[model samples]
Target chain A: MRIGVVHETAAGERRVALIPQEVDGLRKAGHEVLVETGAGVAAGFPDAAYAERGAVIASATDVLGAEVVLFVRAPGSDPTLADALLAWLRPGQVTVGLADPLGAPAAAAALATAGITSFALDLLPRITRAQAMDVLSSQATLAGYKAALLAASRLNKIFPMLTTAAGTLPPARALVIGAGVAGLQAIATCKRLGAVVSAYDVRPAAREQAESVGATFVDLGLDAADAETTGGYAAALGEDFYRRQREALGKVVAASDIVITTAQVQGVRAPILVTAEMVHAMAPGSVVVDLAAAQGGNCELSEPDTEVDVDGVTLLAPTNLPATVPAHASRLYAKNLTNFLKLLIVDGAVRLDLDDPIIADTLVTHDGEVVAPRVRERLGLA
Target chain B: MRIGVVHETAAGERRVALIPQEVDGLRKAGHEVLVETGAGVAAGFPDAAYAERGAVIASATDVLGAEVVLFVRAPGSDPTLADALLAWLRPGQVTVGLADPLGAPAAAAALATAGITSFALDLLPRITRAQAMDVLSSQATLAGYKAALLAASRLNKIFPMLTTAAGTLPPARALVIGAGVAGLQAIATCKRLGAVVSAYDVRPAAREQAESVGATFVDLGLDAADAETTGGYAAALGEDFYRRQREALGKVVAASDIVITTAQVQGVRAPILVTAEMVHAMAPGSVVVDLAAAQGGNCELSEPDTEVDVDGVTLLAPTNLPATVPAHASRLYAKNLTNFLKLLIVDGAVRLDLDDPIIADTLVTHDGEVVAPRVRERLGLA
Candidate 1:
């Protein structure tokens, strides 16, 4: 079997699907690997490294002739690339990468028209067996960690406490509204920076976790037993709940020198936890990091990907923290891609076993048709 | 001492500082309470109710004449109101409410100039005595719960499993990333909805919590011994740890049909867990609720407050889940504010003691000066 790796054409994307070390893994698996020139340059993996790892350098056209094609951001990501790749795709050939199927349903359909079997890596299932192949979780961990750093960097006060010779500097106080990965990480990072951290969660079960992280869990004492869905995500509560929550949370938000809000419901607007009034309640010079800014922010005064000074407080809504640290993010993402590829290729042959949950679940287009039920509906294809 | 409640002026804010029942509590404490007419309209409390509770209803101007002015969103919230109330505020008077001190630091200073001592209820500290006053926690809990509901509403499949005549529709598989308040609530909510829920947290201690919530804890094998900070939050791991973590977590993300990413690090952007590639790998029709969408989302395809279809996957990033259900949210918030008011007013007098940790910590500004060191630094006062 032969595998081709192409450079990512997505703007600001610096990751490669398969790095040099992964190419070596493919070689060890008794498969031939082809690398387009400079595929790994942005991610700090030089072409020479791929060559050293037993990969053959080739042009995009030459690489596409392989049994399988791999990319970081494939076809639907860039129109020009999608057109170029469509011409090169042969019948029964396999293409894999992040294909924006919903954003561009036609792209997957195009692949079908070209008689190419395409698997969108973004659709991988979340299972124990496919843990290494889970790209979402891998990249999210980085985003969570990066959010904390971004907040701290722009924060007015130092995160940690210090007992200086002149006086004992009090530890900065940080309040995290959401207890998701980003919120938890923020709490942890702020704590590490020596800030006195406190966190709040809607779920009664979150108290223990918050406490475990050494942050005092602030409980609003509302009965939200009925607020959860069976799918393990927050269900939208009645308006009464949100009103009461904002009223209760306002006090705590005002006291904190730094406030980081990470509360967002799925398919809904980000909850406005810190209203303009709440922001005013905070002392002058306080800082707020609205991770939900892109969705309109948890803070009323927040603007997406911008910094706003309200009263004396600073509100920061960073658009992409992971991208800020692209070098490491790309490396981690590349590894995830490599792990995913390993599961699809066996003994130098691309195997599409619908019996395998992973393979069946991830295969969006097969036999030159949009076979996935959801994609079919989205594309209005019977 | 006389207490006055004023109507909130901030847009879309309907909560009042005190409900009719709360007014009764103040009266029992031997204080005469006055409320601005229609202050509690949004919370479903009418002026007549306050009158029935032996409280006086007056205009916003008249309400400011009391020794202590209580409000929902006032003073720093409305410059016009702040100006209008200036003449009514006497020396030694105190104003307490969800003041937007961070957004209107100058307004707080103006209170000092008016010879009034202002207590921003939003600045209430998270302490044992102040626990009931912790508004941030209460609102967050509701927001978390509401987030789950929003996800369920927009999801194509039902959350719970049911054995019907047709067959058993297996429970939806929900993956909650981040073990904070919202994440935990999301987990609990999903479980209640009859979904098989799994949760992940960077902090090792969160595993027990995940189990406690009846959700399976997904652990990516990594040395997270140093993952906790003294302040009790999950500390950010080094780049190497993130690399291994992504590799390990990829499998779990791929298996989930409903993936709610709640991972947020404080003051930072939400981590990107579901990359474009990861989304493409998912089975078509799967849904991803990037609770961190406002902070630029955990899913690669998520556009904040927008519903995007990636292949068959739906990426929903609604910004303000709480606002959608403002009724209950306000009620809970009012209760928190009421509880905090009780603590501050002991025997009909406002206490400004710096001895109590809760009080001292929450006193961000007083006597027309920025009192919080951290806040001062943020204002460049230090």
Candidate 2:
């Protein structure tokens, strides 16, 4: 099979679908790989590197001629590129990457009209065997890690403690609102930086995890045992429960020098943890990193992807922490892509076996039809 | 000291510092509690409830004249009310609530200079003794739970599986990137909703937690032995480790239909987990709940507090998921505040011994100065 890697045309994106090293892996797997000129340059993987790795460097036009066209962000992300790709696409050729399919089902239909097989990675099923292929988890780890770094850098005080010639500097206190991956990482990172960390979670089991992370668990004694749904996610609490919980947390919010909140229930708006009142309670020069700011903010004063000085506290809602460290983020994403390729490509041929749980589950559009039931429902296709 | 509860003046904020029922505990502890008219109306508690609970309803001016002022948020949050309170504040009075001390340290200092002692709920320490008083953790629990609900609500597919009259709906696959409070809630909620859940964390110890919540642990095969620091938080992994981690996770992301990424490193940017390429690899109509959207987003296409469709995947970054259910959120916050109040108000008198670890650690400012060392350092006050 021949795979072509195109330079992403998405705005603010510098990552390539296939870096030179990944190309080598493809060659080792007995597949031919082609790279558009300068696809990997921005990410520090030059076109020459691809050639050295047994990849053929080609123009975008030549690259798209292959059996499979890969990209970090597909043409759907860039309408101008989408038009060009639709015109250039050959029958039976496969297109893969983030294609914005739901937002532009018309584009998916267009691909179908052109007789092209397109795979939208965003629809991958969550399963054990597919763990290695999960790009979301891989990238999330980076985002979680980066959020802590951004907070620490912008924080007024050092995260860790120091006992130099001066008086002993007590460890900075850090409060992580959510005990999710990012919150956990924040706790871990803060602890590493010698900050005293505490965390909270709605699920009963999170208490133990918080304690294990050396963070004292803050339990708001709400009858939340029933708050957990069978699928292991938190069921939305009643208004009564939330009122009680917030009252219990008020003190903690006021005491911490740095509060890193990563609280969100699935599919809902990000909860406003740091109310304007809470912000007022914090000392001057306190910093709050609201990971949920985009959703509306854990802090009431938080503005998405922006930093605001509320009273004396600095509330930062960074929108793209992962992009700040593109090199590592891209590398991780590329590896996820490689692993995914390994699953669908067997013996150098792309196989779409509906019987395979992994394949059947992740397949949304197949043979020019939206086959996934959920997707069909969302698109009102049924 | 007679404690008085004031209604919040911030627009759209309905939580009261103390619910009428909560005042019973304070009264039982031998403290006289006063409630401002309509303080608990939005939280479903009426002034009549306070009268029933042996509490006196008073005007805002009357409440501010009490020896101690209690509120959901501090004066900075409701400048108009705070100004009124300041006018009536006598020297040596005490004020407690979410003060936003760091954001509004000057305000706190102003109160202190006026001979009023202030305690910021945001400053509560993460310690065992202070756990009950930890307002941040309690509210975070709600935020985490709320995030999962938001994701599930907006998701195209049902969270759990069902053997229907037509056929068996395979269990929805949910991947929670972070294992913090919100991530755990998402996992628990997803599991309860009948989805197969898998979770990832940088800290090796989080595996036990993930499993406890019925989530399969997704290990990326990295040497994470050093991932945790002494304080039990995640240590920042070197770039090399992050590279390998991303590679391992890419495969997992490619298989999940619902990827709720809660990976946030404190004070930094949210890591980008779902790249445009990764999203493309997913099946169409997938949903990505980027809880870290405010910090930049775990998904490449996520816009802060908005929903973006990438290749048929819905990237929802709700900034204020909790606010969506403000009634409940407010209730939880009230409870947290009540618990914190119990810690400081002993026998109708405000205590500021500073000998207690919880109190000492949480004190951000005192006597018109930023007494907290961390706050001092943040302000460059040596």
**Which digits, one per residue and each the tens of the lDDT, describe model 1 over residues A256-330?**
988888876643577777889999887654688888775567888899777798865779886545444343445
Off by over 4 Å in 2: A74-91, A98-116, A223-247, A264-269, A293-300, B1-382
lDDT of 2 by residue, B1-382 (tens): 5889988886556567776657777788887888999887665566788899999999987898988788767764454555556778887777777765655555665676677777777676556666556555555544565565555544444454433211233666788887866777678766754579989988788889888978999988777788665644445567677667777888788788678887765435666656777777765546788787755777778887766877456778865454433334454565666666666767666677788866776566566666766556545674
* Minimal lDDT window, size 10, model 1 chain A: A160-169
Looking at model 2 chain A, report the run of 10 residues with the lowest lDDT sum: A160-169
Clashes of each: 136, 187
The best candidate in terms of TM-score:
2
Assess the local accuracy of residue A86 in candidate 2 as a C-alpha lDDT between 0 and 100: 81
DockQ result, candidate 2: 0.02
lDDT per residue for candidate 2 within A1-382, as digits (tens), equals 8899988775556667776667777888988898889787665566787899899999988889998888666654445566677888887788777665655566666676677877766555556666666554554544555565555544444454533211233566788888766677667656654578888877778788777767888877766777565545455667677667778888998888788888765435666667788888886557888887645677778887777987557788875454544444566567667777887889888898878876675555556676666446656786
